[model samples]
Target: MFDFAIVGGGIVGLSTGMAIYNRFPNAKVVVIEKEETVAEHQTGHNSGVIHSGIYYKPGSFKACFSRQGSQSMKEFCQKYDIDHEICGKVIVATKQEEIPLLENLYKRGLENRLDIQRIGSVELKEIEPHVKGLGAIRVPQAGIVNYRQVSEKFASIIEEHGGEIRLNTKVEKIHEESTGVTIEITRGTIKAGLVINCAGLHSDRVAYAAGYKTDMKILPFRGEYYKLKPEKRYLVKHLIYPVPNPKFPFLGVHFTRMISGEVDAGPNAVLSFKREGYRKTDFSAKDLAEALTYSGLWKMAGKFAKEGFDEYIRSFSMKQFTKSLQELILEIKEDDLIPAPAGVRAQAIRNDGNMVDDFHIIMGKRTIHVCNAPSPAATASIEIGKEIVNRIPKQMNLKESKESVQIIK
Candidate 1:
């Protein structure tokens, strides 16, 4: 029997495993991933912007964790000799009417204690010459990195510390007992004294298997992106985002200069028929049936019918998608956008058509389930792992925090 069993091989799971193994070196820890590699889901595919906690409400988990996570992620990268850049981002206001919203965002940035500066059109032009905007907020703390590399580093640390990472292991059921928990996988059964569910895309289903009733349902929203051709990449110097519509869940289509020296735009959020569905038409019968039958989906459809329709239109029409990009930068033509990979956000929608804004975690006597972790999750993975480790009881302390499982140098 292992001391800890973690489900999911994404950044969150890997970081959580690292944190746990750091605290308990002697404990037999195992991380199980349904896929052959780690971060094959949302963690692997995202805008890859290390968020500065500017958009989140102050005092919320998103705000606290993201702020700390950014620092931790940067520190971890430096220690591990990983590739990253602390290139700042700007939130722009292209229209005159968008000025106040830009100001509000700057004020929110201040409230969040971010190193931010409000710049006029002149400074904005200096930062991004080709981009047109009336005003902008320069978030100096924002940065970029390849989270997949970070996940791999965490996996290596876990293995070096004597933890097992079992890939192609899908847990079908979880049974909890007075002593611990029993996980039934496709290969066989594994019993653990404690189980932490960090299953990203299938977290809610895993929680259900563990017998926790959540009012929120996991709604998959595919954020489709388009990469700017190498020649057109110079159009965006830094990440350029718009003021998010508080009524909706996603931050509007934006530009991100990735660590790999490529610029990608968009990631318009739309409902996905399958949990891990990335393609426009890829659908699972059960995943589709669950979403269509969910009352929350219907409620959301009734409320945001216009936005929903627009998203669906963009999903199937390249012309419409290109038009949306034109709002941020007019230079992007239909042909400039080649096929880009997609990430499905496991958004937790409530019964009242509300999208969960904060990170949601549930605790049992011997289990903890991460139900929702959306944007900035990759940036916030380290701090989220630390926070989760703090919540675990003292008896589970199989290793000391100060113990170097491996040489840091």
Candidate 2:
């Protein structure tokens, strides 16, 4: 029997496994992933923007972890010789009405202790020549990195410390007893003293299978993107974002200068028929049925009917999508764009129809389920892993192992 078993080999799971070895070198630990490799989903498909923790509310998990995670992530990258850049971003107020919202965001950034600055149109022009905005907030700490590379490094560290990474191993069910927990997988069964449910999109289902009754349901929202053509990429010097609508949970269409030197634009959030649906045609009947039957989905739909419809429209109409991009960078044109792979966000919604704005984690008898972790999740992944390790119950016997730990200091 292993001392610990972690489900889902995403960035969070791999980082948790690394953290566990840091604390307990000789402990028998295993990471189980359904896919053939780690970071195959959200972690791999993200825009690779290392968030500066400006958008989150102060004192929330997102705020705390992201603030600390940014530093830790950069340090980790530097130590490992990974390719990354601290390219700052600007949240622009393109319209006069968005100025107040922009100011509010600046105050929120200050509350989060971020070193951000408010700039007028002239200053914004100096930074991004082609971008047009009345005002903007320049977040100098924002950066970008390939999280899949970071997660792979985490996996290597776990293995170096004698931890097992079981790829292509799917957890079918989880059963908890007085002594330990039993996990039934595709290949066979495994017993562990504790289990961590970092299953991302399937976290809620995993929690329910483990007998935890949560009032929230995981709803998948797909964010589609378009990459700027090589010749037209010069228009975007740094990340450019719009002031998010307070009523909406998404960050709206934005421009990002990825670590690979290509600029990506326009990721409009829309309801996905499948949890992992990346393409418009991708569909799963069961996924659609579950979403349609959920009371929360209907309630949320009713509340944001107009915004939802607009997102759907933008998803289908390239011209509409280009217009949103034009709001930030007027030089952008339909001919400058090319379709890029999309990502599905596993957003959690309550029975009351409200989206979980912060990161949500719940504890079970012998399991810890990470129910909601989306954007900035990759940015805050290392710190998040430490947070999970810190939350492990003392009864689980967290004493340090006798073997010497090999984790890089």
Candidate 3:
């Protein structure tokens, strides 16, 4: 029996596998991914932003882990000779009414002990030449990195430490035995002393398979993006995010300069017909039926009906998407925006239609289920992995569970 079996080969899973190895050198660990390669879903499609942890509540997991993970992630990259940049990002306030919200965000940043500063329009113009904002909060710590490359490195390190990584392995069922759990995958069955379900989009389903009473469902929200035409790439210098809607979970449409130097704009959030749906036409009957029959989905729809409708409009209409971008950059026209690949966020929504704002991790008898880990998860992956490893019982540890966190920095 493997000491630990980790489902999902995304950044979180690979990170967990590496953390387990670092914590328990003699323990046999295995990572199973349904995809042909690691990080094929959420981690692969990551926006490549190293979140600054400024938006999360102070002392929250999102804030603390991101703060730590951002540093640790950069260290791992540097050690492995990966490409990364610490260029800053700005949250611009285009309207006077957004100033208060921006100020609140700045306060939250200070509470989280971030190196945040409020910049006036003059400073904002100095940073992003074409951007227009009355005021802004410049988060100097925020940067960008290719999370997919990081995930691959994590996989390599796990294997180097005697861990096995199984690819094209689809976990169909998980049965908890008295001593351990028997996981039934596409290839065969495997026994594991402990199972870590870091299944990004399919986490709830995987947990339910293990008989965990999950009161939530994973609702996939597709964030459609438009890449700036080559000639229009000059419109955005770095990342220019608009003041997000306080009521919503998604960061509103904005411009982001990727690590490859491609400028992308306007990833309007809309419901996906399938869990892994990347295209608007991609639909799954099972996924659609589950979403349609869910009371939580309806409740969420009812609450954000107007905003949801607007997102749908932007999803199909380039003009509507360009309009959202124009709120920050006036020179952006529909012609300058080209269709880019979309990413689906596995946002966990409670039965009451309330979205899970915090990280939802459930520890069962012999398994740990990561039910919900939304945005910034890539940025916080290393810290998240350490936390998961730390949660294991002392008796189960190969050495000592109380080992101090080894910082790569």
Candidate 4:
């Protein structure tokens, strides 16, 4: 039996696998991915921003991990000769009313001990030539890197360390026994001393399959993006963001200069009909039924009815989307944008209608389920991997090896 079997081959799972090998080099570790390759889901679809941890609550997993992960990720890239950039970003307060919120965010960034600067309009304009705002928070630590590349590197390191990565292997069921956990996959069953569920979009379902009861459900929210036309890309020098709506969980439509030099804008969050739905036309009957039937969704809808409606409007109307983006940069016109590939975020919502704002993990007998990890997850994958490895139950018989591999910086 393998010492550990990790489900989901996204960045988090791959990082966890790397962490396992780092902690116990002699232990047998297997990473199982349903897709043909690793990082095909959220990690592959990510915007590639190495978050600065400014927006997260202080002392939360999102805050701590992202703060530490940003530096560690940079070091990892440097060590592995991977391509990454520490290009700064600005959170602009377009309206006078948002200045308070901007100030609050600046304070939070300070509390998180980030290297952030509160700049006035002149400085904001100097940093981003076209962005219009009363004030902005310049976050120098925020950067961009292709997360798929990082995840692929993690997979390679795991393999080099003698861990196995099974691709095109979908996990159908998980049964835990006194001796080990029997995981039934598309091909066959495998026994493992422990299992780690990092199934991004289907995490809750995976936990449920293991007979673990949970009050929260994973709701898929599709974030559609529009890439700037090559000629119009000059408007955004770096990452430019508007003050996010305090009521909504998503960071509002923003402009991002990717590592590839292409600028993307306006990823408005809308409820998806399918878990993996990327386009407006894509629909799944079961996915829709589950979401529509969920009382938690209805409660959440009632709480933020107007904001939710606005998201749907922006999702369908290009003009509305452009208007939202215009709040950050007035030079961006509707003609300067082309629809880009969208990503679906797996946001966990509780029965009481509160979204799980922090990174959430649940430890069960012989299993550790990552119930909620989104946004900064790609940014904090390494630190999160270390955290998960640290959470491994002490009762599990780990190999006695004095020479532990150190993956962390």
Candidate 5:
């Protein structure tokens, strides 16, 4: 029996697997992913911005984890010789009213102990010359890195420590008992002394399968993107983000110079019919039915109806998308943008219609399920892994963990 069987091969799972093997040297840990490769879903499709934790509420999980995760991720990248940059990002304020909100974010950053500076239009011009803003917060510590590469490194470290990473192996069912948890996989059954459910996208289902009453439902929101034309790429020096809606975590569409040096704009949040749908036409009947039937989705839609409609407009109409971008860079036009790949966010929505804004996890007798982890999740994966590892002892101590003898035929 394995000491730990982590569900999901995304960044969170890989990081958790690495941490477990690191913490308990003698423990047998295995990470199982349904995809053929690691970081295929949320981890792979993100905007690659290493969050500074300024936007999150002080003392919140996202705030603490993201601040430390940025340092941890940067250190890991340095150790592994991965390509990364501490190239800062500016949160621009296009309107006068946004200045106070921008300053509020700066205060939050200070509370989080981040390296942040409030800059005026002159300094903003120095940072993003082509951008227009009344004022901005220059988070010097904000950086970027390829999380997929980081996930691959985590996988490598886990394997080096004699841990198992089973890709293309999907867990079909999870059964929990007093002794341990038995997971039925595509290959064969594995009895684990403890199971850590880091299954993104399908975390709710996995949690339910493990007999945990999930308080929220996962509603997929597709964030569509547009790549700036090569000639227009220079308009964005590094990363230029608009002041995010204080009510939501989705940073408004802005310009980002990726690690690969390509400039990508947009990522408007739209209700996705399919949980893992990357394209507009990609549909899953079951996924759609669940989203449509959920009162939480309807309620959330009603609350943010206008924002949702604008996102839809940007998703379909290039003109609307360009108009949004022009709010920051007036020189950009419709033809200056092209469609890029989109990302699906596994947003946790409660029945009461409130969005879970921080990192949420539930622990059982022999299982730990990470339920809600979005935006900063990629940045906070390492620290989040450490946090999850800390919880294992309370649920099931690997040093003393025992398992049932049930095996597959």
Candidate 6:
């Protein structure tokens, strides 16, 4: 029997595996991934922005882990010699009314204790010449990196430390009781002392199977992006974003300069047909049935009808997407945008129509289920894993080593 069985192979799962291995070096640990490789879901399809905890609530898990993860992630990258960049991102306010909202974000950044500065149009031009904004907040701590690379490196470290990572092994069901837990995978039954569910898009299903009642159901929101044409690649210097509307759940469509030197324009969040659906035609009967049956989704749609309508429009019409982008840069035309890959976020929404805004984790007898961890979860994976490891019972520690584990943030 393995000491610990981790469900999912995304950044969170792999990081959690590494954390457990670090704590109990001799203990047997195994990570089960349904897909063929790690980070092939949300972590793979992400925009690759290293968030600075600016938008998260102060004192929240998202803020704490994100801040700590930012530093620790950079450290891990440096130690392993991974390719990453600390290029700053700018939150721009193009409308006069948005100035106040931008200021509010700046205040939140201060509360989060981030290194940021509010600048005028002149200062903004000094960094991103092609970008336009009346006022903006420059978050110097924000950066970008391919999370897929990070997850792969984490798996390597886990194996080097005597952990097992099994891919292409879909977890069919989970049975947990007082005598540890039994995970039923496609291959065979694996008995584990503990189970950690980090199944990104399918996390809720896994949790429900493990006998955890969740008020919220996972809703798939597909964010479709467009890459800037080769000639217009110089349109963005760092990252150019429009001040977000406070009521909406998503950050408005904006421009992001990927670490690969390609400028991407998009990520308009719209309802998706399938949970992992990257294309329009991709559909899953089981995933779709759960979504339609959930009353919370309808309630959410009713509450944000206007935003939903706008998102649907942008999802189908390229002109509408360009129009939204026009708020940040006037020179961007419809022709400058091309079909970029899309990513679907597994946003957890409660029965009352309220989306779980913070990082949520539910602990059980021998299991820890990560029900809701999106967006900044990738950026904060390291710190979040550390926090999870700290929460594990001290009795799980088998090593006689007396070295104190440093817990930052």
Q: What lDDT score goes with residue 127 in model 5?
A: 84
Candidate 1 ranges beyond 4 A from true positions: 395-399, 402-409
TM-score, every prediction: 0.96, 0.98, 0.97, 0.98, 0.96, 0.97
In terms of lDDT, the poorest run of 10 residues in model 6 is: 400-409
Off by over 4 Å in 4: 400-405
Write candidate 4's Cα lDDT for 1-409 as tens digits.
Answer: 8999999999999999998888888889999999999999888999999999998899999999999999989999989988999899999999999999999999999999998999999999899988899999999989999999999999999999899999999889999888789999999998999999999999998999899979999999999999999989888888998888887888999988898999889699999999988888889999899998999999999999999999999988999999998888887888999989999999999998889999999998999999999789999999999899999998887864555546655
Model 3 lDDT on a 0 to 1 scale: 0.89
What tens-digit string does per-residue lDDT give for candidate 1 at 108-169? 88898888999988998899887777888898889999999999999998999899999999
**lDDT per residue (tens digit) for residues 164-245 in model 6:** 9898998888898776789998988999988999998888999988988899989999999999998998888888888888
Residues forming the 10-long window of minimal summed lDDT in candidate 4 = 400-409
Candidate 2 differs from the real structure by a C-alpha RMSD in angstroms, to one decimal, of 1.5
RMSD for all candidates, in order, please: 1.8, 1.5, 1.4, 1.1, 4.7, 1.7
The residue-by-residue lDDT of candidate 3 on 58-104, one tens digit each, is 98899999888888888888888889998889999999999999999
Candidate 6 local Cα displacement, residue 345, angstroms: 0.5
Alpha-carbon local distance difference test for all models: 0.87, 0.91, 0.89, 0.92, 0.86, 0.87
Q: Give the local distance difference test score of model 2.
A: 0.91
Error of 5 at 371 (Å): 0.4
| True-vs-predicted CA distance for residue 57, candidate 5, Å | 0.4
Error of 3 at 199 (Å): 0.4
Pairwise TM-score winner, candidates 2 and 6? 2
Candidate 6 global lDDT: 0.87
Which regions of candidate 3 are displaced past 4 Å? 400-409
